[model samples]
Target: MTLSRRHLIAAAPLLGLTAPAVAQDAPLRFAVGPFQPTAGDTRRAYEPFFVHLAASLGRPYRLTVTADWAGIAVALATEQLDGAWMGPWGLGTR
Candidate 1:
């Protein structure tokens, strides 16, 4: 069963079409800065917000908040997270 050149060419676009759908399945990483009084405080304030966002997006969202502002920057730079909610200073640096 050899694959003809025409068959290969026909399949190429199908493969490309599947990529976007696969990418859409990926989970979103939400980096929540230490923008609150504490980890507990931040979680309490934003946990519901994130749940709603994730539901609306039809994707999972993992909340990550560093102990300090520097940690949040490192996570963002490394691409460990996709986006973040930051305070005034956090937004300024990014």
Candidate 2:
């Protein structure tokens, strides 16, 4: 999703909740659904946020652009992704 610097700053604290357990050398995996019109658009919007986050946290952050919401969910459930940005409704009832 396209996140402004303000949004990222606000989310930093919440995202940090999971950061402690991750090793400093390990890359934090972050996934984003096809929220923007195109993958390139999404990446362009989010790339800077991840870069800033990585710098702020002093750890590398990997951004995975998923084609669909289901892929994001599966990745999270399987622990392939440490975090995700998607619509609340994207998460279906189990």
Candidate 3:
């Protein structure tokens, strides 16, 4: 589920579409699958991009490093996450 910078760039349009519907003051909750060796490493690796995203969108964001696909899936299904950074192949689009 690790994302290259390219993947991040490609997701910008998707974010643009969804970010606006989020409440203006609520922190945007984002999740990531177990992309790195550890959660800390994953968070650190993606922090800069997420920071830039939040700042550029003028919104606060909370990043969560999920332990596995199921963890991220649950977060999204339950609305705990607004978006996620994942490999496109990891989950098929409906």
Candidate 4:
């Protein structure tokens, strides 16, 4: 079945390490920092990667482009992001 953007958005809050009760079919929400020239550019660059990841895992994957490193961190910390591509500096101390 084709997953819609609404479905992915609905699943965002329950994605990633903190989501133990998430369904197996739930889409993985992958977050990326704003390191590229634009959000569209970042999405274009990583779309193939996410597609391959979904195919390999037999599950759907969604890409979320954050406005900045802080946004990425917030998404991760709040369990809204299942995975992330970010720099070490963005990973603040615990």
**Ranking of candidates on TM-score, top first:** 3, 2, 4, 1
Off by over 4 Å in 4: 1-23, 87-94
List the candidate 2 regions with Cα displacement exceeding 4 Å: 1-20, 87-94
Considering every candidate listed, which one attains the maximal TM-score? 3
Any runs in candidate 1 off by more than 4 Å, and if so which? 1-22, 89-94
lDDT of 3 at 64: 82
> With candidate 4 superimposed using the best TM-score fit, by how many Å does residue 60's alpha carbon deviate from the native?
0.8
Model 3 ranges with Cα > 4 A deviation: 1-13, 16-23, 88-94
What's the lDDT for all of these models?
0.60, 0.67, 0.68, 0.65
TM-score for predicted model 3 compared with the true structure: 0.71
Question: TM-score per candidate, in order?
Answer: 0.63, 0.69, 0.71, 0.66
lDDT of 2: 0.67
When summed lDDT is taken over every stretch of 10 residues in candidate 3, the lowest stretch is 14-23
Clashing residue pairs in candidate 2 (N, C-alpha, C atoms within 3 angstroms): none
Model 1: per-residue Cα lDDT over 43-94, one tens digit each: 8887786576556545676887677767767876776765566766433112
lDDT of each residue in 1-94, candidate 3, tens digit only: 6665456446655654253544367887777778789999998998787687666556788988888888777777776777777766543111
Score candidate 4 by TM-score against the native.
0.66
